[model samples]
Target: MATIVKTPAGTWKAVIRKTGWPTNAKTFRTKRDAEDWSRRTEDEMVRGVYIQRSGSERMTLEKALQRYLADVTPTKKPSTRKAETTKAKQLILNLGKYSLAALSAEIIADYRDSRLASTSKHGRPISNNTVRLELALLSHLYTVAIKEWGLGLTFNPVLNIRKPRPGPERDRRLAGDEERRLFAALNDYSNPMLRWIAVIALETVMRSSEITGLRCHQVNLQKRVAFLPDTKNGSPREVPLNETATEAFRDALDNPTRPNDCDLIFFGEPGKDGKRRPYAFTKTWGLLKRKLGMSDFRFHDFRHEGISRYAERGLSAQKLAALSGHKSMQQLKRYTHLRGEDLVRDLDALPKRRPTA
Candidate 1:
């Protein structure tokens, strides 16, 4: 049974009280709308399929995202945490006002399209991979809210939605002339560590963060191995050093700028509080890129180049995986794009075989 009353403002207030269920009430501008709502709610209650969506209705996506950032984001790796936080902020800006209950697949698809259509601050179009990552964060938020946070969502809106296709794998590797020009330009930079960063990256196939985050205790020059306590995948790995990498590390250790105050090999100057942190060479790298007119070259490309070079030298997939810290063969394959000419050159050395009877 339902009771519909007209208040002083002439709006219809409908209230439904059912046994074994929480009382649901709503104010509507019209009596018919109030009647309709009460009827639907009562029917849902009778069917035992009614979820108390008060939490979902009251909580906006912005609030959910903020809560997720506070609770779940910290558990990820540092780089992942930072990236997810930024993506959460972007989602809030785009769909903050919508309540969790109202976040349907259709609404999420619209957001996906909008993000795809818009250009980023860097004047580049947002990649499908970036959008996919953003959607993943949103999906995780809903999962956490339902399973742990007591938000009674019947289903995750993001689960059914078609995710954007990821962009093609990048196969950019440094050419001989390009490499020469880059190293020549890097030599002109004031920071000697900048050159060492590039050299070690090409030789060891280590990420920029991995290279920068090295502590003196983590390196074993005699063993020619660098121990990474914190990697992007949250797994500790021992990266083997080639002859070039060993020499670069030796020089880095011998450099006069090697700070005694901090354990970081590429230590920056002390801040206002007199704390030294890992040197951030992004700006320096960018300036060097612009000076060399090689705008497409990114520091991460060094990893790609190093891995490809290793594959060219006849390293097996298993061997490459161990050296590169790649857990998945698929990911390793992406980094192992050998040039057709090199393959042909190897094939040319083999003698032609006759058909067997």
Candidate 2:
């Protein structure tokens, strides 16, 4: 049943009390409006389709994003925590002024279009991948608020909005001459660990962060494997080391002055206070690339090259995923490319068939 009454202030208030549903009340300037809203809300509740949007209406996107950052961002891997937090902050700056309930597909689409036309500090147009990531953050925020945080959002606005198209897949691989030139440049660089890290990345198909964050106990020289206790996917994986990678570990371990505070294998010299940190070599890599006139290459391309080489060596998709710590075959597909000559060799190796009598 619903009760309609006029308050002392001369406004009509309607309150609904049901057997199973929570009591809901609202005030309107006129009795008719209150009565109509009561009837529609009662009917929706009886049909089990009532969503209490009042909470969402009262909450701003900024508050929701703040809560998500406080509650969810900490659970991510350390390698990605900083970057995800930065992206979340950027999103707050972009859409935080709107209320959760006021956000619509049109508003989100406008945000997307504006971001696509935006530029980075380098004056380069923002990449589609970056815009896509921002949208993904908003989408996930809405999902968490609706399902876990009880924000009472009826729908995710981000889901209805169209996302920008993703950029072309990066197929940049190291050519043989380029690889030789790269190593030659690495030898000229001052950092001794740079060459070893490069070699191990190629030999083990590990990422730059994984390599730089490596510790002594994680590696077992005898077992020829490295145990990554924490990875970007929040799962532990064991990476097998080839002969070249094992030798690299041996050389890194031979550093008598290795940091005792942290077991980091690839660590820099101790500071004035005698504290060692992970080797800061990204700048060195950039300088070397520029010096060699190979500015387009990135440290990540080493992992791509390693995985591509394994695929060309006739490693099956299943085996490659296990080696590369990829949980899905689809994720593994990005690195499964074979050169024309590699495919030609496989074609030549086909067995000849004998004629049947």
Candidate 3:
């Protein structure tokens, strides 16, 4: 049973008189409306499908975010750790106060609209890729909670919609003057060690991940090769050294350090003074780019450059894939898209047109 009444504010409300599975709905605005809704709710409850009001027992978006961050973040790659942390903060600001159970496809769609209206500290518009990552993080947590933790989720709204198109691929490969400018900027590095670091960055195109993880044992200078235990591809690959790389290693060996230190190539050995710290690629990456006045250059692009440069030089897709450690040539081929010059060169090399007899 339910009672309907007008409030002091002159709005109709309903009060439930019996316990129901959905916690006994309270306000319906009119007696007839209240009765109809209550009957429907009661019927659903009888079928054991009714979802009651969340009220005090509901989990909040913020709580879900914290759980995801604390439990799920540690297992991710170091590069993604910062991104996941940032996503958690953005979710807190966007959907924090909302109840998890109350979320629906419609609500999340509206949140996407709101996310587009948001900007970063740099005043540039947020990209669809950035927003997509945030949604992905949320979606993953929901899945974990429902499947592994058994939260009884009937639907995951995030999956119901497609993410927006990602932003245009920023040009990553350095060409011509940009490469020269990059080296010019590194020229004034008073610390010879930093110079060696920059040179190695250009020569090997090792990611900051691989760079920081480098150990002396990983470098087989005797064989002019370096083996990565795990690259971005989740597979190991050996990087062959050129004379330029060999020279840089020689400089690295001569680079100033404490008398007794560990085998770390970049950072000095941990807990020791003077160049024993492990090489931190990110710290120097920003300065290197700024010095070159290159806004679009990324450390990751160096890898792209290394792969694509000789990729244009007629390296077989299989060989390139082996070097880059890409699981498939499908994705790598896109990066090595042939240029007009390549096409023209191929056409020029075609057999001369024989005179018609």
Candidate 4:
């Protein structure tokens, strides 16, 4: 049963007290509304489906995100934590005013459309992958809120909306003479580390971050292996190096400019905290690429080039996956773009069968 009363403020208050349930109450501007809510709530309680949404109704998205950053983001990897913090700022700017209970599928879908249509600060159109990552973060936030934080959200609105399709894969391989010209320019650059990083990536199929973040102890020229304790796929790998890669690692390790206090092979200048971090050369790389008239060439393409070369040399998919740290064959396929001429050459090398008799 429920009790209804009119307060001096002239609002109707409905209070429900059942034998097995905790007391629940709500206030409404109209008595009819109060009676309707009380009936619905009591029915839900009887059905054993009642969830107290008062907290969710009062908590805004901004507050929830703040709590998530403080409580959840720290548990993730450092790179993941940094990326999610950036995405959180965008979510706060766009949807922070809405309460958890107030955000609907329609509202989130509209946000998706607007974000896809928006442009980045660099004047380029926003990429589908960027929006997808942002949406993923939001969806995870909802999942955490409902399951862990007990926010009383019935369902995630993001799950009900369509995610943006993945963008087209890049197949840009080094054209003839482009590689020679690029390396010649790198050798001439004032910084020798850039050339070493580029050479290591081409020879070992290692990612730019993995190569740049290397420590002195991670590489062993004697063993011809580089031990990666952390990688993009969340797996540690020991990348076997060829002669070229081993020599590059040796040169980088024996760098005359190597600092005594820093363990990083490619250490940057001291920061405000007086701590040396991994070298960051994104601006320099971009400027150098533009100057070389290869503005479209990206550092990541070196992984693709290396993987394709390995595939052409008849390496098994299992071996390629081990070297590249790819968990799935399908994902490894994206990095392999074998030249048609090389395939034809292999086809020609097969022994001719005797004519059928």
**Per-model root-mean-square deviation over C-alphas:** 1.7, 3.8, 4.6, 2.1
CA lDDT of every candidate: 0.90, 0.87, 0.72, 0.93
My TM-score estimates for the predictions, one after another, are 0.95, 0.84, 0.80, 0.93
Kindly report which residue stretches of model 2 are placed more than 4 angstroms away from their true locations once superposed.
Answer: 1-50, 269-275, 349-357
lDDT of model 1, residue 25? 81
- lDDT score, candidate 1, position 196: 94
Sorted by lDDT (best first), the order is 4, 1, 2, 3
Q: Give me the candidate number with maximum TM-score.
A: 1
Q: Which candidate comes out best when scored by lDDT?
A: 4
Better of 1 and 4 by TM-score: 1
What lDDT is obtained when candidate 3 is compared to the true structure? 0.72
lDDT of 3 by residue, 1-357 (tens): 556677777666765554543335456456677778767766676687875443323688898778777888888777677889988898888788877777777888888888888888999888898888888988997788676654556667799877877777544667669877777667766555666766676677566567656777788778998899877766788987778977897677655673444676666435544435566556666877876678667776766777776666777888777766677877776556455676798789889998999
Error of 4 at 309 (Å): 1.3
Q: Higher lDDT: candidate 2 or 3?
A: 2
Candidate 4 stretches greater than 4 Å from native = 5-11, 352-357
